[model samples]
Target: MRITVFGATGGIGRLVVQQLLDDGHQVTAVVRTPAKLPLTHSHLTVVTGQLTDHQAVEQAVSGADAVISALGPSLKRSTTGTQVTDRTRTIVQAMEAHKVTRFIGLATPSLADPRDRPHWEHKVLPVAAGLMFPNALAELQGMTEAVTGSGLDYTIARISNPTNKPATGRIRSGFLGHDKVASTMSRADIAAFLVAQLTDSRYRRAMPAISN
Candidate 1:
């Protein structure tokens, strides 16, 4: 598979790219700063560009079988303020233009999954998050809406706090409401699952929460 990846420099995105390469898939890693992705592989092609740049995004998306986005705001990058929705819209439009179907991206539980019967922590945590980080919650909600409405073969993997741990390659995953005890997932495991979804049809068009 030829895959285009946004947020290739992010914690989970880098691991996803590496795993895809290990799986013998062609990877186009799109990023604003090419140097941030310190990997060199025969199958990995680094494309330097911003997600909001349509032509850049198209270049990355062209000839790709799937697109995976782990995009999120970085505290160091002050310019990335609530731009996930805008970026997602641009990517979806480009995907439509190019006739690429599969898209997998990240989201949080704060977006309100109807199927999710909230655990006590789930119910109060997002409210606290909203109070502490109103802008982030709103942006996440916007991104969720954009992906859900894109009408493509899209899956939004909702995760909570991600840690830097080895990839266990095992996860408890289900649709938003199915898992009530999930609180954290390792970045490696999340990347593993995202790459697996490239060919898996079970979770197509679903927002499944994954955790260790």
Candidate 2:
């Protein structure tokens, strides 16, 4: 598969690229700074550009079989929260133009899934987040709306807090809110799951929570 990755320099995105390469897939890593991704492989092509640039996104996704996005705001409190929603609209347009169907993106669990039966923590946490980080929460909610309405074969993996630990290769994933209470997952495992979705149809057009 020829895959284009947005946010390729990010934590989970880097691992996603490496895992795709390790599995012998062609990878186009779209990023603002090429130097941030140090991995070099015969099958890897780095495309340097901002996600907000339509031409850049189009070029990166031109010949791709699938597009994966790990786009998210930085941890800094001062960051604006609209990047994910804004950039994803561009990606959806680009994908439609190029006739690419598969899209997989990373998302937080704050967005409501229709299949989820809320737990107490799930209920309280989102309310707390809305009260605390209203802008960020709203941005994520908008992003979710965009992807869900894009009319593509999209899967948004609503993940828990990601750690730097090794891949466990064992994850509890479902549309239910209480599938796992650990509320933590390793970045490597998340990458593994995203890469697997390239060919796996089990979760197509579904937003499933994933956790260790």
Candidate 1 backbone collisions, by pair: 115-177, 116-177
Lowest lDDT 10-mer window, candidate 2? 174-183
Residue 128 CA displacement from its true place in model 1, Å: 1.4
**Which residue runs does candidate 1 get wrong by more than 4 Å?**
74-81, 118-122
Top-TM-score candidate index: 2
lDDT of 1: 0.84
lDDT of 1 at 35: 86
TM-score of each: 0.92, 0.94
lDDT score for candidate 2 against the true structure: 0.86
Residue-level lDDT tens digits of model 1 in 37-150: 999999999998878789989888988899999987542323336678789889888998899989999887666555666556567768986776776777778878887887
Q: Which candidate is the best by lDDT?
A: 2
User: What lDDT does candidate 1 reach at residue 141?
Assistant: 81
The CA lDDT of each predicted structure is 0.84, 0.86
On residues 1-212, what C-alpha lDDT tens digit does candidate 2 reach at each position? 99999989999999999999999999999988989999999999998888789999998889899999988755455667588789888998999999998999977777767777866656776887777777777777777888899888999998758999999988878866546535689999999999999988988998888888
